[model samples]
Target: MPSTSHTAPITADLVRGALDLEPTANGILPHRLPARARARNTDGQLAMAESQPSGVRLVFRTRATAVELDTLPTKRVYIGAPPRPDGQYDLLVDGRPAGRATATGGNTLTIDMSTGAVEHTTGPAGTLRFTGLPERDKTVEIWLPHNETTELVALRTDAPVEPAPASGRRTWLHHGSSISHGSDAASPTTTWPALAAARGGVELVNLGFGGSALLDPFVARTMRDTPADLISVKLGINLVNADLMRLRAFTPAVHGFLDTVREGHPTAPLLVVSPILCPIHEDTPGPTAYDFSRLGEGRLLFTAAGDPGERAEGKLTLGVIRDELKRIVTQRAADDPNVHYLDGRDLYGEADHAELPLPDRLHPDAAAHRRIGERFAAHAFAAEDGPFAQAEE
Candidate 1:
């Protein structure tokens, strides 16, 4: 017997973690940063990262035994690098992963790093279907691909669906670099932030933009406006890699960013996390470039481009950034008890690096992501003195 299929319109009320939704030609596109914040900058990498929907998902309650979603994904392609895999959609039934699926066709975004050229090729949307679910009412969460820019076109189920009721969980808003953006992670729900959120028993709003976590004023402003019970900003790696600022500018920028966030969340638990172990950039500054020598050998790796001697002229490195961050947070914590600091090395440090090294010399691999997520959960949520412990309690 054929099962009845009910089509449901994808609307803002059904989405979570995204700040804004843009009405697209075929569907709705989620944006981590609202339109006003996005309009203030023109960096292509940042623009791409914000639209990838790292922590965004659709949450609804239904008794459907089968479900389907139509999407238009913009998959990224590096002209000279290895082929990237198609994005996967992770389905969580009642907060546990039940199934995973990938769409068949979507648009392709090709990038030529050698010439800094980009090309976009449009294609038809594809559908992802899941079947054989429990027929009783349950909360269903469809976590979108963390690394792909996806548009929610349509949703179909065997039964009616409604927005899930609030779980009364504290919202943890986090902002960081590529590692936190699910780089090299297995799937959306397996990303370190997502895993940590699950362990912490909190809702997550991840603003981790890949290669774009520089302390931008717009990003600070956006963080200031967002509502969150707990907040964390992981800085330093992008600043070091991008060679965006030096010691003098970095201190002021950190203060300004924290000040802006405190304006809206004066009493919220604000955690400032430093960069993790990246040996390549620990003492050396960047403007890191791909190792073309290894690329031909079917390996994608990175090399530091800045000279070590440049450090004397105020070029920032991980070491320098960590010290500055600790000092700034210490100075501010004197009056504001809510602001706290966490050394990122405590999450993924020298020992972890030796056991599970970063595959690309930049991003952590799947195993490392799980390790970091577990460590983060223990340090941030389980510890009685941890910054996020109160939320869990």
Candidate 2:
């Protein structure tokens, strides 16, 4: 059986009706459905209406200060997650904040913009509704308060939109730090992941979290669990800047993370990417500092020095770590046939650095993003025998 229960139609009317329920005087509703709505739960699963052409189900993980949702006309937005009272999220349609919803520390909050009803619940799910979406493609921006950290777990449209044919395309799973997460990228679409995915003609799952891609085991587990035909892990820079772990732990941790991923994607083509040339960290271990006050003065500077007494304990420099990554991957390739390596320096080197330096001397600017994307696509995808090589017809 194809599971008819899972195939139940999800309709706008059902969504509208759900939103139509009035909140009590206390401005709260049951997070779980009423017993009656539960009766309609097909096999203990909440049935979402089948996606319509005008609606889509966009699902991915994001850790960003701002996020945008792209959808069609007549689309609505629904969210289900544990609420954080101290954390507030702004929902922007197009470029302006369309609605502001607060997290009440409840299990869920449902916003029915169609009825102008904002409902809070304690059970386990939340919804945000936007009626009268523009007929053409629309972008919903979720801007997090500065320095606030959050993840976007899922996004979907109400209607069934056709997925582009996947017949000949390869999938790419890329992991990196803030830059990869689209930090300071002019727009979401201009982010390197989006740009690279578009250029390579491949599906992409971006696990780039701003300030959180610290070779965490949980992240490695997440990557291990994801399905993909191609995988690349960008390491360094953040580790150096944050000075989170010393070399002893950092090297093994990197190996462990890669090991975990390889366990799940044994034969999948894996590319381990080292950090690009960073002069500040090129010779010294850095707990880099910035003077935000000097931003308007057009004078941003970073100071780097070897940690006193910790230098021989092996604090990692960009140069040292890059060599270690190359050695590690080269050694692993002795037994793993599909594993490969990319020196991030190859993407942007000292020469390129001199020509198009990063504004922060840390993260690249928009122009640098385009340059890196182009180089990545050429080296990683355009190569005929590379991981993203097109399949035979």
Candidate 3:
């Protein structure tokens, strides 16, 4: 007789780290941002970034030794750049990494960055299967790829499965840019925020949209409404790189963003972090553009396009942002005792940058991700007086 295979319908309760789950024709698509916030935006980059499911995962419990998941992934392709790698699915059993797999076939989005052209090609769904698990009932978590858009199709197991109960961990809500979205990271669980959350033993809700963390009012509102025990907002890089605002507008924007968030979580431990070391934008203004010189060599690099002299006219730079953030936090902490600030350099600065340089001139590479994760965990969670520290009984 053949073993009975049980197919489990993917439901909202089974999904973790996602703010909303939309039902699709084949399965459910997890969304980090809710529809209300998304509806107010029109930027293509933000749309793509939010749909990537950076910190989202599927969690359940079963005694099955074999499990399978079918998914449809949307993969990106730069026309003149090197091919993008397949997205990875990380499997965890009882909170430990058990296995890893990558889906083969998926829909493709071909983009010509220079020409601003895009073409979409549909493809079939692929399955990720894991076998030879311990027979005892165990909790399983499947972390989706942090850089690809995936639609959860179905789940199958050799034995019965059910939704795992919450672990009673305090929820930590974080918002930031691509680095927090897991760009260039080895895997989803390895992203600095995810790794830090593990060390802190807290539930994570990541709102790290790539190239789109420009102090948007909608994003701030989203953060304001989300329930959280601890909160962190990482800003500056995106604002500087996009040349979206000058020092004049930035101060008020930051204040408004925090003000909105405080409306919901009046006394939650809120931490504001600055941008990490990016040499090119350290003292210069941006509007950073691709190093078209390296494009022909199939290597992507970035160079600051804005004039450094613009700083005299109030153009924002990393250095300026850091000073302003420190001042802002210091001023607010006088009345809002629970609010705090962490210098991004403390997480990864000149010393660490010399050892593990950012490969793309912007985003941290895999090794850097590990270093950032460990450092963030130590500074933000493990320290005796850290904002994310556990409350005394």
Name model 3 segments beyond 4 Å from true. Answer: 1-4
For each candidate in turn, the TM-score is 0.98, 0.61, 0.98
Report the lDDT tens digits of candidate 1 across residue range 27-136. 99999999999999899999999999999999999999989899999998999899998998999999999999998789999999899899999999999988989989
lDDT of each: 0.93, 0.56, 0.92
Worst 10 residues of 2 by lDDT: 48-57
> What global local distance difference test value does model 1 have?
0.93
Residue-by-residue lDDT tens digits, candidate 3, 273-379: 99999999999999989886777777798889988899999999999999999999999999999999999999899998999998879999988998898988898
Spell out the clash pairs found in candidate 3.
Answer: none
Give candidate 3's root-mean-square deviation (CA, Å): 1.2
Lowest summed lDDT window (length 10), candidate 1: 1-10
- lDDT-wise, the better of 1 and 2 is 1
Error of 2 at 222 (Å): 0.3
Q: How far is candidate 1 from the true structure (C-alpha RMSD, Å)?
A: 1.1
How far off is residue 339 in model 1, in Å?
1.1
